[model samples]
Target chain A: MDLSPSGAWLVIVVASLGCYALKLAGWAVPARWLEGERLQRAAVLLPIPLLAALVVVQAFAGDRALVLDARAGGLAVAVVLVLLRAPFLVVVLAAAAAAAVLRAV
Target chain B: MGIGAAVGAYGLSFGAAGVTAGLSTLQTCALSLLLFTGASQFALVGVLGAGGAAVAAVAGALLLGTRNTLYAVRLGTLLPVRGPRRLLAAQLTIDETTGMATAAPEGLAGTAFWATGASVYVLWNGATLLGALGAARLGDPGALGLDAAVPAAFLALLALQVRARSTLAVALSGALIAALAIPFTPAGVPVLLAALAVVPLILRRRRET
Candidate 1:
């Protein structure tokens, strides 16, 4: 957590501008590139794996160690609830409640 | 509009997480205002909360934000705007807005995008402030186990998305890569590298062809 306030600001600024750049990049490209096979494939396949990566890292990794605590339990519960097709808020709050209750016990 | 506001609840979580990760209240609100993407905002705060590097945070957010680019490309033709107007569309070029625009009947694309985008932006940012203030008052976040909320939410989303065979394969592969890589690389690196699952996807597609 050595991030100075300024350093955090820098990251935010860059991320915001980078987002704008991506949006502009879409418009800047000829319509052909968007229709091209390679980009299309990327658009389709990239999010699945990328989102999976995010879920794995967030769920499993804790302080550089993979610890299965309440978070893991909560994640499992959330997945099951989602499979059961619960509402979005119910899924989220239920997961958190599961984690909190598990931690308390 | 209700969906937009519901998505806004994500802002509440971001506000809390950002504070837990050591950002000032002003800074957290500033992120909600400027970055305005839930996943990216969460990535920044998540990486930092886990003591990951700032650069890694930015990289992860940028990676996730690329989805908006895809949205933009798809929405570009449908939205009839240019110059300054195009900028408005770009600012609103997010998952919800693009989704709304795409699903709208015929000529209603512009109305759908603008309306949903405006509601989400306003409600999400407002909810962020309220959540931040509440969290700031709650003192330490660990007491309530709010730390678990982010990963749990992401897990819920993954569960919904991974119903198909191809998605399941990619998700499992990505998880394996991240688990294997965690010990050696920096915190966020493994997550980004998991995108290498794309390689196998491409190879499979080629073989099918």
Candidate 2:
């Protein structure tokens, strides 16, 4: 489980290759195989939970504990900006700024 | 064009966040160059930053990158080219490019795809280099709240995908699972396990159909 700095290169190479392979598999795999309703549905549905989990982990998780730190404030700002229909850049920057301001105060 | 710029702009955050997460500037820029997908890149660095194992980090990133495969499936029929061009097409089959390409008029789809992909590629990589160098120079990233910004970026990325009720349900379920698992599981395990939240939605869709 432990990864040294040098091992990171291996991870980077492996992940980049794996991701590229996934992208290529779509192009190379038979169109018929992918056309199945269930397969396509799964493809479309998969990212939802993964992304949501990422948001939760990034915002709330800390050292194996669910700690609501400054990151939560940042995410709250991001939610508001998303609700207000802010552009992606604006939402991200605003969240960082909000968290920074909160920590400063 | 505007969309490419908007998505490219986020590359700066990726750069800063990557360095803040302890990646070398070269490693950070290499991610934008190679992985290209924002969420996957972030997941990799995010896990590494949290002191997770490399395997878990790659697993999370690869899971996030799976959507690009679906994007390629949809784009394969639209832009038909072979040899090296197909390789290039696969590399460029990301969210912004696919979105732009799919939405374009039939004759213009190829142009849309290439232009958006190229612009995003250039701007994203360029911004990544700039952001990484800039972050490296910054003595302490926490002072600028970069830690908080990383999750914020994830939220921004997720917002576009949660349009429908089922997707919302899946997202909430995933969030709940990750939150519950955080206390007991390792750093990236929760994210991977939360993907199981989609199983219920898939079952429901099959039943309704």
Candidate 3:
């Protein structure tokens, strides 16, 4: 099959290697340093902001101009799903349906 | 994390997107197999679909991947494997694997990590192929708002992380950053901002007794 140029494959290889390097760096570092209190503390708290930023980006990025489009409508549906504690599958379907309908209209 | 199912479903969307963007099934599968990161893969495809340069898309994907560096640091110590095994372990170290593995109790960490990663890998790639084959019939997944499913699923994952004491602050910070950045940065940048927002909290914890 004709792929999108061999260069794209190279991109995949490099990206994969780069990701692996980061993963390996953790073990490659000395045990004592990694196990230290500072690192431990950082790990414990890192998720909060990382997750926060992620949520922010997801919610508002496309709404940049703040035009109330289907994406925004879908996001509202997602908010409701979270509030209702809907199952993941349910929430996803709800949001996707909302977006699809919005797009169609 | 239970987000594995959502991730798998999203892979279907990605597969469909790949086909629409002129990628073949083998190419889509290769993308999933090699660069298993969802957000980056999506960004790359989005860029490619938008007629952006392949080189630029690759660069954007790499930059977005910087956060995995932090995951490596955090999870590497939790589940240490030797040389060759380390390669496979790294391949499996996505958000779900790292989050589930790190949170699991001592003896169960390894098992949880492997299970989460392996499960996501299989389901995601399988769904990708399915999506690719059915791309024509699948229509617009975004039109169906399947795209929102991921963020909603992620929100559910976040809810599971909230404890009684810090739940409000954590949730607020995430919301605030997401809201603030949505207008400014691109898709992945907001996630980076969210990760960065936690740095102050980490610093505060360090200063405490």
- Fnat per candidate, as a fraction, reads 0.55, 0.78, 0.51
TM-score of chain B of 1: 0.93
lDDT of 2 by residue, A4-78 (tens): 778888888889999999999888887777777776777777778888888898888888899877878988989
- For residue B176, model 1's alpha carbon misses the true position, in angstroms, by 1.7
Q: Which stretches of model 2 miss by more than 4 angstroms?
A: none
Q: What tens-digit string does per-residue lDDT give for candidate 1 at B114-153?
A: 9998988888788888878877888866556676677766
The DockQ scores of all candidates, in the order shown, are: 0.62, 0.72, 0.43
Question: What are the runs in model 3 whose C-alpha is more than 4 Å off?
Answer: A1-13, A36-38, A41-59, B1-7, B10-28, B37-80, B94-119, B132-136, B160-171, B181-191
Ranking by lDDT: 2, 1, 3
Which wins on lDDT, candidate 1 or candidate 3? 1
Quote the RMSD, in angstroms, for model 1: 1.9
lDDT of 3 at B43: 53
Kindly list the per-residue Cα lDDT of model 3 for residues B119-175, writing each as its tens digit: 999988998888788775666655556455445544555665566555458667756
Candidates, ranked, DockQ: 2, 1, 3
TM-score (all chains, Cα) for each model: 0.93, 0.96, 0.69
Model 2: how far residue A83 lies from native, Å: 0.8
RMSD of each: 1.9, 1.6, 5.1
Clashes of each: 0, 0, 12
Provide a comma-separated list of chain B TM-scores, one per candidate: 0.93, 0.96, 0.67
